[model samples]
Target: MTETVAAIVAAHRAGTVSPAETVARSFARIRAHDDPAIFISLRDEKEAVAEAEALGARKDARHLPLLGVPVGVKDNIDALGLATTAACPAFSYMPSHDATAVARLRAAGAIVVGKTNLDQFATGLVGVRSPYGIPKNPLRGDLIPGGSSTGSGIAVSAGLVPLALGTDTAGSGRVPAMLNNIVGLKPSLGLISTAGLVPACRTLDCVSVFSLTVDDAMTALTAIAGPDGADPYSRNRPLSEMTPFPANLRLGVPRSGQLIFFGDKASEKAYGDTLKRWTALGATLVEFDLEPFYETARLLYEGPWVAERYLVIRNLLASSPEAIHPVTREIIIAGARLSAADTFAALYRLQALRKIAERAFAHIDAVVLPTAPTVYSTAQVLANPLELNSRLGTYTNFVNLLDLCGLALPAAMRPDGAPFGITLLAPAGHDAQLASIGRVFHADTKLPMGARGLPQAPLAPLSANVAAEEIAIAVVGAHLSGMALNGELKGFGGRLLEATSTAPDYRLYALETTPPKPGMLRVQAGSGSSIELEIWALPAAAFGKFVAAIPPPLSIGTIRLADGRGVKGFLVEAADINGARDISAFSGWRAFVAEAAAG
Candidate 1:
């Protein structure tokens, strides 16, 4: 069975395996796989073993999250021993330091194996545009490896490495994962710094993760996600730890007749099956028009954003025009022809489209779409490179353009052996929400990992309590999940920890407010009904702001739960409940609201 990041770390901690052994195993696998196009450069096995030995000697080695795990970096990312080549040899250069994301992974005790191959300058979704030969799709020899993160995807899927970093501007990260039957996590833009990354589209590019499991992908994401002083685009957004799948999850599905499978009935059927699975798992499917998102996707290439891609390779285009791949050069050279007027027109249209996309999410937790419209063979894509590549980005191209985060999960292996996958997308800071739901959905599939059919390890246990950086707040009324004002808590980056009942000593009252609300008040022990509520963890900074926004009688106070745990929550002053009605018999706000709505 292929080792997962968690399994490797646990083995290292138990003294059953050493970092050096893992690093050596990774190299051995690389040689055994024998795919020269999978990596543009590799570190000496001895050098990596030495680094692993050094890491094991550190005092905190046992506590490191990814201790001794090997990671493959996309060639576009700068790693010490590997030259930064965006698959263009003439554009390669040695960096004085590791990229910020790479450095963070190392700090977490990951060993860098080598620089993986990519689409030239990350200019194409099809992995074949690299000057290096196309990486053989681990699942099928004839299929395109899906790129520009081709090598990174193949490395993880082939079990050459447990984790690898890919960069996504327009589906480069996700398209390949679907083709390879692996997990592809495209975190919020700027969550992982681009400081040491070769820019594809400076604004839209994000470092992505490829792993055998959604949990493994998330572990890698947390280790590398953060603000960086060196990266102007990096923001101080707090990444909430994933929680148990929440009840009442509403997933957006494209309106009927809007989905495009390019005549591939197998992919279309697989997607339908995936939606049915999501329904069986208790998610509510809501139909939304996907036209605006498609428009936004078109703007990515049809607009001025191509200028960002060209900006990176302009010097190379000027000095060694022939060195760039013909397909890549053809795509990027168009950037130079776009005028400022064209750029602004697109930006303005994109902003308007973003607003439309936002409205779609107002009722749904996330939009579920096929990772790619369909798969293509290397021969087919090579013959019709540009058009075929554009079709692959059907669902993915709009994500980064609207600043949304995405999680790609392998849904099923098609009848023809092609892998079909689904992606869950949400507004930027809701990465954990996608992960929370995605982990559940992926595990339920019970599919084998990657191309080798390795049995997936058991899902790792999630933290039942809040992290030190967060504060737990109990919501009893409108702030509950699926309630009237639940978006406010979500707006503050709150994550659902658990749905539980309060200790049997709180009295629930319907408050007199414009928008109906419920407030609980403390009573003598064993004298009141047990009021139901949800506990959510909000970032400490956001918690303070959320507390300050409490109006009049509703105030933040200690509320005890059925499990004897106490948390700060909404409470009403006794004096303010004079005109309020006692709703303690209803037990919960949702129940009372449902009863009222039925009338």
Candidate 2:
């Protein structure tokens, strides 16, 4: 019985064992396992031991959050003194610093034992394309550990670490989790900085979290996440604005006919039975056209995004092509086949498919589907590498391309004892909603954490952009639900509350200006009718920043609502009313804005 992360933390917190003991234990495990393929490099034990003592020696040592927690980082991420190979020896390099995500974790008191192996150039979904051997699935020994995050998944699933960081371009983070029976959280794109990461498909790439429990994954994510100005892709989204999932939530499932299981009867049956469980949990299952999603998925492999990979190591492939793994080299070369026109054509089609995807989400809070259509053995993945790897991405390829966040968790064991799992996908900013409902779905499955019976906590899906700290602010326009600049509220973790009318004392005005601002004036008693506005809960940490984001004329002030409750809502000074037009007759901001759009 190996100690799980929670167990180790509890022991250290209670002084039963020190951080040095934990690191020594981790080194002992690595030595006993002696799987060369599991990690590309292992850190020196003395350095880790010395660092552990220096930290634990402090009188106020408990302040460290992940204090003395040992973690494995994927080799693609640069850990100081560790070589980054991305599984290609020719491409290996030593970075002076750790990746931004890794740095944050270390700062919070997590020690990196070493860099684990990855698929060649982090290109293939199958975890075989490396000079080092593939890591076997920790759950099912004969099965392939999901790659390119293959080893990261295996290390954590094996209880080597409580957590690890993996990059998701085409389900690298999630696919491995499914095979190993763990939690893989691919947050909204741009949620984690890609600055120190070697790009997979730069635009679609996201740094993902892997843990045995959803709670652990969330804890790790909340610690490392936030905008990285260094990485152009990083977005400063809130973690507090995301609200709790309501009971009896609406879930969208692809029309059964649309699911592709790739000839795995066990997987198909496993998925179908899971849906029944979803229904039993008191939720509506909405059937959606998964064709558009499939279309977006196709673009990932067939489209120019492969060129993003080609962009990164063009020189390596051009100079020493022979050094590459045959399958990986073959796939990397495909980017050369794509022309600029082909790239633009794919982009054009993606835009059209995204519109249809919007309609898919309109009727459902989150969509449920397989993390992978099925699983494969290491030998099977090697025999027909291309086709088998492509099959693994059948359900996953669409997520980031469609600008969505996802969480992959084990559901139940397949009849063969291989793990089966599902992913819940939602729009970019709705990460919290997907997690809220996803926790329910995960809880119903009642599986053990990772591959062992560690008495896991029922997962509580973490809201990716929740603003748990801000005051709820009601805004009629510009900050209205799905309106332009609404990101301002989300930036500070503002959550949208119910939309209700204002007290009859307030009069509505559509401010006369370009881009159109709105103002509501409090009138004499009984002179004005109730107007509509949406309440947003903001995280306290983000309130000041949220206020600073508000532009001219509109300001936070006490506004009366229909229910006799007065909260902070948008108010405009009376002096701005001279040119403002009365849009009160149009009712709420939504109606006024829609009419304007139609006009």
Candidate 3:
């Protein structure tokens, strides 16, 4: 369908296609598809085409990044001139303006094709909890589409649109992506303004993007992410420029005891294969306990957070309880019985669990987990709605509670032909980092884009326009991605540049520190081996502060790269190496540590 935003923009710029033509093609596809369950309401073809024609007429159309792109907005978000029903006709409202995120897309020249259906009020992970018919899973009609962003996911997956907006309080954004075979990006909370979104656990809700590729999802994120004065929850975190993944990333996976597949052998094998793929790509997998994270996840539904969901429709639930879905009403009404003490007790427990979750990240660049433990057929989920819906949130509900960002990318297809996906998760503000790795990993799979039958395309090159005041630094040990001190680098807004080796003239030593660190020492020619290292770019202004924070025995100095370039990097003071263990045989800190653990 020529759905990618980049391809459409390039075609327009090359004079091969016009915005009006693209919009017309979008309408034609929607009409041909004829899925009444997909969209609650669609813009009239004439109105959308007229808007596209007007955009094409602008002298600066080329400056608009999303020119001619057609996108679907989840019905929960307000789009001007459309009724915002959130899949519940009883609660529909007409908004005079677009949501801030929607406004940004329009500003970038994206046409709002329609308001897609969702699980009513974003309540269920299963797609069937709505008055509107369930959005059919494009891959197999018998499978549940996955929700609450069901229609948005289906629209993009089926090629009716290349991009769609969704919201993730638990797994709304990611689960649907997995079932549909697409990319879903749940940006760090407060990164994307939620100003016009109807409340659904307001504090945890994030405006998410769904697209055919990691690059496309990222493009939409770039266009929409920012602070909004109107949204008090919005923060001022600027999006980091995209960079290539560092060579030696450490990804955390659940320990064998913690890996749950709900008896689905296909899903189990798919996840295992995906882990092997990550290791093959030069990433180290660290197994960690998932108990604390699971505890945090339990709080989302079992604790007082349900109170927030109830608050969204308190009056309606009281006045017309029968009007809502019976199960949804039961779930929300449970909040009314909770005491204030129960809320505080849950908050206290969450605080303790959050600390444990944060420690899990100290040794990994990100956590790689199955987006959902398993998939379900429509009949299976319908038969056991409550139990199955809770099960779907197994790997997703804890994300917002832990204040993490996640990227869900298609990894492989199961033996049975259903798609399998893995999510890369990191602490808040690491959205771009997840994208950097996800793009490369997704491309490696060579999977088609969703159900469109189009081969995955190469990612667009990262922007070369670096900020003038940036400095590149080479990190060798604890400061490397996914290591103990890695947060210090990320905290200062550092972005990984590359994973390469230093000139074959340095010896590495394990220093005497609490968690241990490595120091690189220059040696005589031909006597040393090329040690693995990673280069990171940080704002020049923050470099001094980072350097000054280094403890004694480790200092910043120039280190030569294999390609004959030099950069400021970590090195050991000559005197400090006296008591340190020479570990040059292992070549890198990760290898040495891994071997030590094995021994």
Candidate 4:
């Protein structure tokens, strides 16, 4: 099999292989693998090959990021030719167009080979809730393949495709990654448009990626991430460039005696070993309270959020109750009984929990947790479905509720032959940060690519130098990644270059604006504390327009970095500081904003 996305693209571009050949090979592998449960519907090989041939004829084919790469999309997301079944036969529909995420992938030169199977309406984490047969777990025949991304995970791990798309609400994305020993990226909510997706939890769902490596997962993410007018929930969360692992990184760990392992000693030891590995990589472990996060996890199914799931298939439930899986129907039916007052009570508690989650990350770069508390056999989960499925979500259920992004990476194959993985999570828009650390950790493991035991490919190189047509600018306050007005920079086609702090000659002040923003002011050398800011590169053609749109009391100026490099950045007028509160002690706008939210 042509293993990684990078290798396949390189071969195609180098004339060693053709796009049509890659597409054909994917279908051949699918037939050879012979896993009926992996894909619910496959594209016509002749049509896909014809499309690939046309793609290769284009002059700009070499420039396409995923040129000729084969991908499998979850059944819930629409693909042009395939029927969107979402694992329920009676609820199937032929979409007029591809889902926004699928459209982006096709635009990036990827070929959609098929729609992978998933739990019915994406309602269960156990994978067996679907009417479709369960995808066989390649690692252990008796072990349950994690879901509702079961088929997507198996597709990548079985070497059928280098990349696949999955949907994540609760643990659908991350749990499957662990069970299959692949990379799963559950991106920030709305980072990828959900316009053509059948909603599981409309408010919390986002498209996810599955691949053999973190870099491969990122390649798929970069091609699809952006705001879409068709998706009201879509956000302009810019994907930043991955940087080398930073020195003195701080990682949050649950306080002692807080982890749940369901009496699986092998999994417990694997998690402990994972923590030790992080320490060896030069990270400082900071302990934090886990009760709040646990409480947030419980609210997903126990509260009104389940109503969102019910809302998606209410018509199907009313028209043909037996058409739905018994377990799925039982769970979603609870949503119908939720009252307005009950919804408000849960919403109020959720808001408070969100604040605590914000503070939880204030002192750490990212938090590491077991992707799943433990592993279960297909027989075990079948016998005790609800409890075991809920247990798998111990670390993942609260992510979307808290508006965070995550990367699930293979940690180790336990002595008992079960796969164990760890997930790195941070507030939304820190996807790049998690990737930076995750890539290094994954390479350190030197694990095989998937169940087939293909040797892991070398890490792909990312360019460190700025492009000639781009101008780099520093943003200190509202325009920092994941901040209130960060979309303004992204809207101008800006890409984050790096995150760094200013020289110890600046002060930050909170300006009294509609939505409070911070301003950075230059002072005498050594007179003030350093302030954190991100450097973003914009096409030189848009630089002038970006600068000219700046409102009064704030303007672009030359700001010096602590590393002795100077760049154009945001600064405040001296007169505006007269009535504003000095916030320089907080170091950066994000930290200050988080502290305020916590209060």
Candidate 5:
């Protein structure tokens, strides 16, 4: 009914579709489509219609975004009166509150359609882990529809809804998106609150969005993302300082040799073709080692983290294990054997891998890789459950574990007609950067929305997350670009925004030092001249680390900017300047150093 949320709102304003009519259309479509597997529990249409009517009765309701746009929910998320089955009967419980992400969507004027199917307790990517019949892949019914987010994907693909909420742990959000050829936005973990959703892997879970287009995904994310105090891992890293999608961008490709295809020739060829398309988009391609990433992924399953899953549902498994799907039961039961020491060992190795991962950002803005090595037929997935599920996550499992945010979008189709896709990933809290770049890639490819043949519409450029939760800190000399301590700022997640001059009340002094450094001192009012400096947005969580990296002579203090914005910038302690030489006349350290060499 609402192929376009914005369009629907416009139409409603133009008197083309009333809120009641929109609700009716959704009800008609659900019955007309008649796919029971698509919804595990249905919301009463009469009640939904009544709510829509009330929305229509409101004055100035036309101003509401996503007005009358009906959406579906994955069963694991809470919605009043809906049984939170999590695709396992034993895990079912009716919740009294909407999940944080769901509450945000509803507040945006989207109506709830129903709760869709998922892999039991959201533990697989193959969709078949559910005791409920696997939702048929709309693109290829015989193939697996993908999991955890399974029914959310199918609902969008089948045109039953324009958007849906799904939980992504490992590849729940992404795998289904790839298989169904829709957009799956796995936000930085905890960017959108997970408060009312059942936990899968608590620390790694993210409430994800599935939509027909990049713009819709962005709109949905902007509405949903914010700090939720209830979620321990929730964070607010305002995208305020991030550069918008660059006109000329650099994309990192996981080195080809490291890619896993699992013997699917068609998928391998399709991926190679996508890489060629990347070149055509004028993106610089750089290859990087992905072993450390894969090493981190293997630990998620090959280690004791499964214990976290068991810890969440130990009682259910103990009391009613038979109620879980056979495959899901098998998977969860494996967790009981791990000792606490195993969890500790995995944590240590993960930290070492984390250091290795930091190296990737130096080479490129985001990393692109196949979303899934290959997708399998429903029968194939069922026959070899664990193996097939693992293959589908070849590129995904490492993402959440490594604290990265990812977006999966459809790419080329395999020769046999199965969908193949790729995910663009960045470190945690970089969701906006990844989404901006993703919009470029999504629009560039010209793929259809869901399984419908409506050519993908252009995204109104992503509003940069410029309100990013980082403090704008300025560096005048030693900690400036290419300086000895530059990495310290970058390691703590500082991103340089611009190089410019400070206000007219600043002076630069060259300090005498073992490892040469310079200090910038703010002058008395109207006295010192403006000096050249660079501004970097330092993540608040990592500001302490950045500060610790600074030596004694330099300290952080307020400095007025040319724009009248007061920000954290470098300053020199009065006692450290006795032997220092003033270089304010040369403009900046680079200019001063260059002139000194000429002498």
Candidate 6:
């Protein structure tokens, strides 16, 4: 069985394994695996071992987070000594410096073992698009490994490395992880710097993480996530501490008619089993209309976003058309015909769709969907490239477009022995929240680590560091996770503590504000409901600033929790509820807004 990041770090700290020994073990596995397509280029064994040896000599080496952990870098991300081919020989170039994300990983003591393969210029969802032979799927060799993060997914799944860096544009990061039965974390756009990455769609591209477990993925994210001064899109978003999943989470699922399994009964069954597990774990499944989300997904390839892809290869497309993959080239060239009018029209449509999305999210904390509708064999995709590739993006293409963060977890194994996975998505800056839920869900399944057939390491106690320095505030309405104006909390460096409910002494009212706001007021215990609310921790210094920004009728006050604790939360004055609609029966602001949207 392959060791996990936590296990490796523990072993290193205890002096059970030296960094040089671990690096050697990784190379041994890489060679023994005999998978040429998994890595396009690898660091020299002696060079990597020497680097590890030097790290081991440092006085503070044992204190490094990822000390001695081996990692694979997607070829598209610049690694100091490797040539980034992005699986295109003609476009390969040696980089003098590491990508911002890679630099952070290295600084945390992670050793870059190699550069993995990918779809040429990251233009396809099916792994077969690469001219480099397809990386054999670790679970099922006949099945396509999913791409364009093909090799990175395979390496981690096969235990060649516990962590790997992949780039997500469309479904490159997530689809591969699902197909390979590993964890994929597509973070909020700009959360991880893309400064040294080759742009697939500059505005939409994100450096993604792949690991054997959600904890490992989160560890890598913590080490690498932050803003880079050189990257214009980099953002200084706040990351919350990992806490337990809420007791009664409202999760949205696509309506029955909206699910598209594409005739794969095994996948359909796997998803059904997953839904049952979620319900069993105390999540309230809410079915919602997915038409708007699907419509938005179509815009990714059908609209001006294709122009962004064209921008990356315009010069190459014109100078050496034959150098690019035929299918990938066909897709990029279409952008040349798009008019500026076409771009703005698509942008306008997206703005309208975003409003619909916001309304949809107001009803649930996160949306759960199959990572990919179905899996295709290499031969199957080769016969029908365009349709199969599009199908793979059914649940993924809208993520970056809508600026949401996602975490993919292995859910079940199909009757046919194929791996099946689901992704949890939320609005931007909810990366930590997704990980919190994802960790619990992944552990509940008790699935083995990737394809290694080893039990997952026991979950460690969540660090309560964020709670120590910040104050937890309960929010029930527009400030709830994924709702409108949630950005204000994020702007104050707030972190979601957990989703919980207020005491049974509170009544909720929908106040008549411009965008509408919910107000909770203390009432007689027998007359009020325990309303759903999220606890967010804000820095002590910023809490004052956050309270000062509140408008009339809403003010911070001590609110009692169901557990008998009290925290400062949003409240409305008694005078404001006179004409406001009493929505206490809905129990939470999400349900109240959902009912309004449906009507």
How would you encode candidate 1's per-residue C-alpha lDDT over 1-599 as one tens digit per residue?
33898888888987899999999999999999999999999999999999999999888899898999999999999998678988988988999999999999999999999999999898888899887888899999999999989999999999999999999999988999999999999999989999999998999999999999988898899999999999999989899888888789999999999999999999999999999999999999999999999999999999999999889989989999999999888999999999999999998999999999899999999999999989999999999999999999999999999999999999999989999999999999998889999999989998889999988776665644698899988899999989989999999999888888888999999988969898799999989999988889999989889888878888888988875568888888898899789999999999999999999
- 10 residues in a row with least lDDT, candidate 3: 458-467
For model 2, residues 1-599, the per-residue Cα lDDT tens digits are: 22555556667777889999889888887777667898999889999988888878877667666788899998888788788888888888899888899999888788899888889778877788888997777677898888889888888887777789999988898898898888899999988888789888889999988887665676677778889988998998976444455766888998868989878899889888988998888878999999989889999988999998888888988899898888988888889889989999999999999999998899898888999998888899889999999989998888899999999988889779899999988898776566666666676677877765656663322222323344666788877878887887776667766667787887789887566878888888678867888877777777777788667777778887764567777788888788788888876777888988999
Per-model clash counts, in order, read: 0, 17, 0, 0, 10, 0
RMSD of 4: 13.5
Question: TM-scores of all models?
Answer: 0.80, 0.77, 0.80, 0.79, 0.77, 0.79
Which residue pairs collide in model 5, if any? 237-469, 238-468, 238-469, 239-465, 239-466, 239-468, 240-465, 240-466, 240-467, 240-468
RMSD of 5: 12.3
Please, what is the whole-model Cα lDDT of each candidate in the order they appear?
A: 0.92, 0.82, 0.90, 0.92, 0.82, 0.90
Q: Which ten residues in a row have the lowest lDDT in candidate 2?
A: 459-468
Q: Which digits, one per residue and each the tens of the lDDT, describe model 4 over residues 242-335?
A: 8878888999999999999989999999999989999999999999998999999999999999999999989889999999998899999999
Residue-level lDDT of model 6, residues 1-599, one tens digit each, is 33889888878877889988999999999999999999999999999999999998899998898999999999999999899888888888889899999999999999999999998899888899887888889898899999999999999999899899999989889999999889999999999999999999999999999998888898999999988898999999967767787887989999878999999889998999999999988999998889988999999999999999999889888898998999999899989999999999999999999888888899899999999999999999999899889999999999998999999999998878799999999999999889988998999999886877778776765543355668878889998888998999999999876677777998899998977889899987656899999888899999999999988899888988875567789998899899889999999999988888899
In candidate 4, stretches whose alpha carbon ends up further than 4 angstroms from where it belongs are: 465-599
How much is the lDDT of residue 395 in candidate 3? 95
- Give stretches of model 1 more than 4 Å off: 465-599
**Per-residue lDDT of candidate 5, residues 1-599 (tens digit):** 44766567667777788977887887798888887888999888999998888888788677677787788999999987788998877677889888888888878788898999988888899887777776778887799989879889989888888889999989889999999988999988878898998888888888999987766776788777889887888887554323445767778887757888988888888888888887887788889999899898898888887877888889988888778777777887888999888888899999888888988877788898999997789888778899888888889999988889999988876668788899999888777777767777778888777776667654542221323477778888767888777877787888877666767887788887767767888778668888877888887778877788778788889887764556777798767788789888987887876676699
Tens-digit per-residue lDDT, 326-377, candidate 3: 8788888998989999999999999999899889999999999999999999
At residue 191, candidate 3 shows an lDDT of: 98
lDDT preference between candidates 2 and 6, better one: 6
Q: State the lDDT at 553 in candidate 6.
A: 90
For candidate 2, the C-alpha RMSD (Å) to the true structure equals: 13.4
lDDT of 5 at 301: 87
Q: At residue 339, give the lDDT of candidate 2.
A: 94
